[model samples]
Target: MSAIITVENVGKKYRLRHQKTETYATLRDTIVRGAKNVFSFNKVDKPTVEEFWALKNVNFEINQGDRIGIIGRNGAGKSTLLKILSRVVHPTEGRITMEGKIASLLEVGTGFHPELSGRENIYLNGVILGMTRKEIQKKFDEIVAFSEIDKFLDTPVKRYSSGMFVRLAFSVAVHMEPDILIVDEVLAVGDAQFQKKSAAKMESISKDEGRTILFVSHNMPAMEKLCPTSIYLEHGTVKKIGKTEEIVNEYLIATNAQ
Candidate 1:
């Protein structure tokens, strides 16, 4: 099968500034500081900027219908890589190429408008995913039933509980039928039954429908169940990539050593 996603030497950098003075200053204080600086022989030093690279030199290729798990300790840059793939953020360096349409559920209520009711946001999110009105309407009832939010369908999502928000968002994302699905750990917000449903749905979509998937999770058992291959990230680099069991075992050993 042809590869659906390719990532090459991807890196993301963030700049942090350290300032000596308070961020907010009154007009009078600002004037006095300016005068003092001008009169003094020594000039005030500028704030220092530090560059932090969250991801560095990452490379991978994912084929169509592949179910891959991404695992790492916190601050491993897993989230950063996913954000780049989802097009939420651009990489500081390197390149990524993807085939077909992409739908990502990186967090709860990712594309939802809080002021809009669940019913309205469904259409809005569908459009954002490149679906036409006809496509959204045809799947509307099925999406609502899967989410189990029919009672609050007309209620603004701002009034929803976190669980309700996740359920509704996940329903819309999966049913939209993108060529590739990227899911982060947001499924942890749902109840056990809902999590099971989500896992099953993802498995079905990748297997039966031949859609590609990128899944990130702390749940080892769940990853073991849903993913045949795994990538272990450590300190913004791919430490290992292979069969799920081998990669997961290596991760466990490293964690114990830590």
Candidate 2:
């Protein structure tokens, strides 16, 4: 099978500011400083700026119909990598090549109009995913049923609980039938039953429909069950890419030793 996505030397850089801490000064010292500032050139303290690489020199290729799990500890750049893949953010020093329409659920309410009703947002998300009105309409009923938010269909999504928001968002993304599906830890907000249902759905899509999936989650069992291959990330770099069980074991051992 051909590779559906290729990431080459991908890196994302961010600038972080650190406030300078001032030592305690007496009232007299403060008055003298103020007087000096009034008579002399006004000097302002600037926060220290540091360049932080959220991801650096990351390279990977995902074949079509691959169910790949991205595993990492906090601040490992998993989310940043996903954002880059989904085109929510751009890499600073590398390139990515993708060959499919992508539907992503990176956050609970991503790609959703908070003020719009669930029914409206479904159509909006589908259209954004490159579906036409007729195509979205054809899948509308299935989306609503999967979401199990029928009673709230006409209600504004801003009023929805996080669980409801994820349900509706996942429902729309999956029903739109994109060739690549990207999901992050936002699914953890849903109930266990819902999470299980979502895993099953993702599995079905990848196996039966030949869709590619990139999943990121802290839930180890779920990740192992859903992904045949996995990538372990640490400190903004790829640590390993191989069988899910081996990667998961290595990650757990390293995490425990820390």
Candidate 3:
């Protein structure tokens, strides 16, 4: 099988405002901004910006039927790289070639309308993740069953507890069945039982269904259980790329250096 995803010399840069205070100068700033928008919306230029590279010269290939873990410390660009691949943010340089439907769970409860009922939001999230109405309908019952929120399905997500919201959102994401699934550290929420079930679901998606999964998580035991190969990132660069054991061991060594 050909590579399902190829990332070649990819780089992402973010221009950071030197002073974040200027972005939200004061409560009056919003009124001024609103008035400016009512007019021609002329750009007000005052804040200085510094370019920061979030991902640099990052090249990797993801074959079909692979579950790849992305492990890195905080501020190491793991989240930024996932956002780039998910199209939430565009990369500043290089090229990425993907040959399948892609769904990204960058964060739990993403792309949801808070005012929508859980059932309605499920359909909406499924559609946004590239599922057809027919497919979503087919999996509707299963999604609800897995989420364990049948009773609250009719309630607006804004009224649901945070835990309930995450459960429903996670269920929708898993049921969409995209060929390439990208997840970013969303296993932190939910009860322990749901977390275990979600892990099993992800493992099945990779091992049984032969999907390509790029998982970013700080949970070492869960990462070890799900990913046999991984990429370790450090300071916006690829620190190591190999077996999960190898990369994780290297990460341990590097962390101990502190």
TM-score of each: 0.88, 0.85, 0.87
Model 2 lDDT vs. the true structure? 0.88
lDDT of 3 by residue, 135-189 (tens): 9999999999999999998898899998899999999999888899999998777
Per-residue lDDT of candidate 1, residues 136-229 (tens digit) = 9999999999999999999999999988988998888889888999999866758999999989999999999999999999989999999999
TM-score of model 3 (CA atoms) = 0.87
lDDT of each: 0.90, 0.88, 0.89
Where model 1 places Cα greater than 4 Å from the true spot, the runs are: 20-43
Q: Candidate 1: TM-score?
A: 0.88
Top lDDT hit: 1
**Worst window of 10 by summed lDDT in candidate 1:** 40-49
Give me the runs in candidate 3 sitting further than 4 Å from their true place.
19-21, 24-48
Off by over 4 Å in 2: 20-47, 158-162
